[model samples]
Target: MLKIGITGGIGAGKSIVCRLFALLGVPVYDADTRAKWVMHHDKALKQELTEAFGPEAYTEAGELNRIYLASVAFHDPQKLELLNSLVHPHVGNDFTKWVEANQQAPYVLKEAALLFESGSWEQLDEIIVVAAPLDIRIKRTLQRDPHRTRHDVEAIIAKQLEEEEKIARAQHIIYNDDQQLLIPQVLQLHKLLLSKI
Candidate 1:
């Protein structure tokens, strides 16, 4: 089975493109959602996180305390890196098992917001970057994610690879700005990927 790594910066429409792929019958593993699940459900990880971040990592209901974790982790770059260090290996292992279970598919997608940043692109056969103009991206994100302030959204964009760099690295690019027709672009890529081995 061919593995495709699909990524884009926050508010870059990566999830929309992934949805289009799924509509075309490609399987997609949403790494961000799975990572959150692993954080709450992985017992060993829970123990390690508690040790690293203290018992506040979980609430009285045993749910992961994301706000508390982020408060400490995001402020301390080293802590954030350490948290990712603990989580990513488990996510990688989980993806491997998921791929093994779906060996019948011609191709599968791993949709992640941080695919390139975490170097997970090396594990895939191709990278699909969904992109848009920076201002459009910020507007889309602010509209879609009401909880994030404009500055909060901009800070995320500032941390990611520049649009040109991501575009240069991608084997495929899906333009998701208001300027393009999304379905036709999706269908074209669908046909193209199906033609490949």
Candidate 2:
């Protein structure tokens, strides 16, 4: 089965594109969601997290403490890198197992905001980048996340791989800019991928 990595920066409509693929019966593994699950359920990974970030990584009830981990890792660049180093391997392994279980599909999508940054793109057969203008992305993000200020959204965009770089690396591009029709673009790509298999 072909494994395609789909990535875009914050508010670039990656989820919308992934949803379109999912609607076509494509197996889509959302890396961000799976990473959170692996961090909580994988015993070895849990231990490694505790060891790296101290016991505060989990709470008394054995749940992953998102706030604590974010506070510790998001602020310090070194700590954030260390955190990714620990988690990405486990997430990668999980994706491998997931792909094995999903072998019957024509293709599978590994959707992640940090596909390239996390090094998961290396394992995929190809990449699809969802693109939108920066201004539109900011506007869309603000509308979707009411609690986040413009600065907060910008900060997130700043941390991601540049839009141009992502587009340069991709094997396919899906434009979600307001002027374009999303379904037609998705259908075209869907048919193209099916033909590839």
Candidate 3:
């Protein structure tokens, strides 16, 4: 199966584009959501987290203490890298199983906000970047996240690969800047992928 990666900076409408692909019967693995699940359920991952961050990583009820984990890792780059090192490998393993289960698919999409940053793009056959103007992206994010200010959105964008960089690296691009109609572009890509199959 062709493993396609769909990535974009925060608020670039990656999820919406993935949803369009999902409608066409393509299996979509949402990396962020699955990563959270892996962090909470993978035994070795939980053990590594406890070792790195102490037992406070999980609560008495065996649930991941997100607040505690974020407090320890969010502000410190090294701590955050440690956390990702432990978590991403498990997520990658889970994605491998997910792909096996959907082996008959013409293509499977792994949608991630940090596909390039996490170095997961190397595992995929092609990458589709969903792009929108920075201002438009910020506006969309603000509308979606009511509590986040423009500065908060900007900070997130600053951490992600620049829009130009993602576009330059992508094998396919989908524009979600509101001026372009998204479905036709998605359909075109969908047809092309099917033809490749």
Best by TM-score: 2
Q: Please provide, for model 2 over 17-121, each residue's C-alpha lDDT reduced to its tens digit, 9 standing for 90 to 100.
A: 999889999999999999999999999999999999999999999999999999998878899999999999999999999999998999999999999998889
By TM-score, the better pick of 1 and 3 is 3
TM-score of each: 0.96, 0.98, 0.97
What would the C-alpha RMSD of candidate 3 be, to one decimal place? 1.0
In candidate 1 the C-alpha lDDT for residue 52 amounts to 89
Top-scoring candidate (lDDT): 2
Please give the lDDT score at residue 1 for candidate 1: 72
The Cα error of candidate 3 at residue 78, in Å, is 1.0
Q: How well does candidate 3 score on lDDT at residue 190?
A: 96
lDDT per residue as tens, model 3, 72-181: 98778899899988898899999999999999999999999999989999999999999999888998899999998998788778778898999999999999999999
Tens-digit lDDT track of model 1 for 1-197: 78999988787898888888899889999999999999999899999999988999999899999999989987687998889888888888889989998888889999988888778888899998998888898998999999999998887887688888888999999988889988999899888888996
RMSD (CA, Å), each prediction: 1.1, 0.8, 1.0
Q: Give the TM-score of candidate 1.
A: 0.96
